[model samples]
Target chain A: MSPKGPAPSSVVREFIKDIVVDNRFCFSFPAETSALNKSVASFGVINPVWIVKSQDNRKTIVSGFRRYNAARKAGLETIPALTFKAGREYDLFIAHVAENTAVRKLNVGEISRVIFCANEHFGHGFEKISDRLFDALGLERSRKIYDMLLAVAGYGPAAKDIVSAGMSLKAAYRLARFEPDQRETLCKWIMDNRYGTSKSSLMIDMIDDIQAVKKKSVDEIIADAEAHVSPDMEKPQRSSRLFESVATMRNPILARMRRDFQTALESLNLPPSVEVIPPNNFEGRHIEFVIRARDRSSAISSFKALSKVAEAESENTESSKLSGLFGWI
Target chain B: MSFPGFSKILIAEEAVSTPLTKKAKAAWPDIAPQIVRNLADHELQLDMEPDPVAAGKRTLALGPNRGKFIRKCPGTMGLVCCNYWVIDLVEGCPIDCSYCILQGYLTDRRIRLATNINDLVDEIDAELAGGTQPVRVGTGELSDSLILDPQLGLAETLIDIFRTRPRATLELKTKTANIDSLLNLEPADNIVIGWSVNTPAIISSDERGASNLHDRLAAARQIVKHGWKVAFHFDPLVLHDRWEEGYRRVVDDIFSVAPPEKVAWISLGAFRFHPSLKQVIRDRFPMSDILNSEFVLCPDNKMRYVKPERLKLFRTLKNAIVAKAPSTPLYLCMEGIEIWESVFGGSPRGDKNLCQVFG
Candidate 1:
């Protein structure tokens, strides 16, 4: 149904079921929908949802999917929408993207969906879409960005959630390379554990390594990690335990070093007021000694006590032999 | 040299008159050579883009060797250095191993072919003439020794030079099967051709554009058959499942084809690299699991497998090799004295004892 004039001048009331979410701009996170629902329930949708007539005469939403869903949840029978007359498919796609861009910035995944829809529905290739259409739609104009977005778009829903939850684009791309079921489990674990981006990336790498080197299935690896967490532990504790277990499995060397360092520290038997800190990641040669003294006399005593302990321990350890040979100690 | 990654050749005006540049042109006939007054002109073309890695892979620059060609290997202070010297030949590698430190170590990605081989040979000769002590030198430090051998033809020149110097031994280490240039030349007892080997699984997955383990072993056999001493480097030994069995098969494969008497020395080094190489590998080889394993930044600023893990890997491989070839001399490359004591029960006193085996 072509518009008789320009577009609808006034907002038209349409039945909630009659408007279909456009596949091109259908991407939405659960939290986004929940917030929109709360906003609609309290003050109602402040802006009109944009819609266009489809080939079968049903109204398809160009933008404002969260508004329509929230309005439905708010117990509204109809929602305000600006209906447009059917025009060129590309023009319609651009209108959808433009309206969304006008409201707020579209995320990477959302931009990917727009590209996917434009490619599928408008027959624009990635090169054409990235070069010509991206500028017009106010998206970043770069082939690399377009390629990365398209790759992320191919990830399953759970993986998409992981990206939306703050995993980096590079990490998301790596996660997309896994098997569908494995990707879902890993993404779900990341989401459930509330892993930060760096941790999430590390966890993904751990899983990938275990799968490759051990030839274990993703289910088996996840099960092994789950076994490390006790049933009595809460969600956060369980997640932290699982992460530790995975890390141990990934780098048995680091685990052993940490154990060795702990043993070495225990052997020193320093006073409670004296804290000896090992180098971070065992990177530096100098071990930091912190004295928790409130006065100068106590600090001096702590330092003297630490020096005696170190000297005595050095004589007994293999490190002391090297120190003696080099005259370092 | 035929790889599609590099499409252009930029030759320094000074290098255009060198025999090495002439050889490069002869090797790659299809690639029209572009001559510039200096490397700075070529750097101007690269300044337009931010992605040096991508640009480096696409351009091959030829220039004279302005720095010392014979230099000491950068060994860490606390580590037990083997006193290995390096003969700087090329600046980049064509074979794209996932764990290559060159990815992060090199500033740019361009394949830098030094066109001043005569100067390099002269410097090596001078070093050998001035010193009475035995020295071990290798060409695989900055780039693979034989990966570009077919195009450069520097291996024969190096082999001839080391043949006359009794105190100097030359090591040509590579992961490729490009030994056609060396096969027909006279075999020198002082020249050791080594292959960087790993399990078959790693060969297929992580080592891109490299020869498979079977072919590399076959090349080793060919080199030994031609009366040259060969070496095997299970360097960057990966800790995979059934690793004992995988390494056992590799050890068996080596002994079955070539005798241990013809072997020069076997070196073992677990996979290690600069921390930055981890992300580079993740981006370049998404399917690779090499970076997923545990690594700690050692005092030397390189990420290495923990001591226990490295010890276990070394002991296992050492046992497998000893079981097969009891007489073959074995050493650890770029490792600390503690690790040496742990594996061999004692550490080499200095470079003197270390070079005695290979020299």
Candidate 2:
């Protein structure tokens, strides 16, 4: 490579270094010559070009791909250049990541994959990254970058390309949250780009919400999400172990008290001034639950039912959860 | 209503002192038993007398003298009927505004008391039918109009009634942050949302239980955003030690959320009250700075700043208002013809009537 070293200042050439092209870099010039010829004719290159030198002393284009192409079209042979720093392959990969990450408009998913590759190449959790570098890069930017990397690593390869191509991070994260079998149904839909960012965003919000539900088993959570997304989808195949656990859950105390509450609500014979909606079990938009009564008198009667339920439940746990549930707070 | 009736109340009160029923003991916890016992006694006495003399329907027991509608403006002040109407939405206010007459007149300190709203709306329907002239009506006098509205759905109910009535314009004046129920309802222009606002310092100390100035203006901004015209009242403008800074902050904050066009009118009235109110205010608000000031009695027998003090405070506040919203019409709530001319150089008479003044 002619003892490859930093270009001497006296060289008659450009000063910039070549930009490495890989899956990591998303934006690029067309790989053609006609457009380059048109560009060099219109305006001289505003900045110096960069190129990688091949073994045996031949210079290869590394950075400034567009300028290199234009210079070639204009019949320029010797382009300006700076030498790439010698380092391990992974170190070079990280250098590429650092460069692309600093670009303002870099897509979050692409940055995520670069970080993922770097993390796989280097061993460290994202949180362990230096705070100084994080602050300089920006917390939100780094967070997004780490979140994308976590997503691709968490979801396998096919999903990674779909996400890196402009799908919302939240949707990708949600799809990754699913079991491999459940996620298979979405693979075709995502790769085809049939789902827009908004729909995927909604799915992501719904997934996070469903995953947070307490007292509901995995089957119940999946069932609820399926009910919302596509009602026509048949129930997923469940083994006997999951079914046995669900069937074994029993709270006769709560059941008996709930029945009593319903009886009280019915007997109140409330005036038309009052309207009652029975207590519902499903997750609601705001309130987790609502116990309806026909009138103020019946509502009071329902409180008695609540008292009984609370007393019975407390007999088992001796905790104040039931009392707090009744607005004791 | 009689002294023996009070003795009978003592006997009934004693009856409730007995241990609560097993039902009550089981349903309620330790304090609930006591509450239930007391509730039983109160309910018995309330049933025996069902109607108190003070509880009956009455209107316009207190307010400034009324002027003919046509003399001030081309049309009647109210949107539906010719004349003014009373909206007894609630009878008592828990919020302690410095200028509130409740400190003077009210004997109770209860919250969430209703004003027989069902009956009030019926009476309003009858009065608006009394004349072809539109009746300008408002509540907020007996109590804050929207303080209990969210829980009671009172705003929704009132808006429902007024939406259908073209001649009746109901003004809901409040200094509360309770506005969620009202925002969802389609309040017609016939309804003007009013806010009684003062400086944050006044709100923090004097107006106990009322929302702060920012919250009040935010509620007003929300009402305006939802297409309701708003009004501001600087009534009972107490000249506390830091009155100027307090008033300027209030004026600046109000303009942040609202513009001149969104405001229907701004009413300014120096703190004036009947002499008897001073003792009641002292007893109720022991720490009130409002009662610490010097005042003189006018011919109306109400206390106000001596003419010069009133002029100075009014001029300074008027400047702030003009600076914030130059185009909004400003009026004196209960000032006389001379005081009106002295401050704003005009009265709620002549070609400039209250309706046109609002526009």
Best by DockQ: 1
Name the lDDT value of residue B244 in candidate 1.
85
The candidate maximizing TM-score is 1
The chain A TM-scores for the candidates, taken one by one, are 0.83, 0.40
**For residues A1-329, what per-residue lDDT tens digits would candidate 1 score against the true structure?**
78433354378888888877766656555425666779899988778887787678888887678888789888888888887776754665666666667776666566667777777767887667876568755655545556677778787888877677655566666675588878998788778888887888889978877776567887888888888778788888788899999878777666766766666666667778887666656544456667899999888888888788778866778654223312210
Candidate closest to the true structure, highest lDDT: 1
What docking grade applies to model 2? incorrect
Residue lDDT tens for model 2, A246-267: 2222222233434554565455
Instruction: Provide the TM-score for each candidate, comma-separated.
Output: 0.70, 0.41
lDDT (0-100) at residue B73 of candidate 1?
89
Q: Candidate 2's error at A268, in angstroms?
A: 85
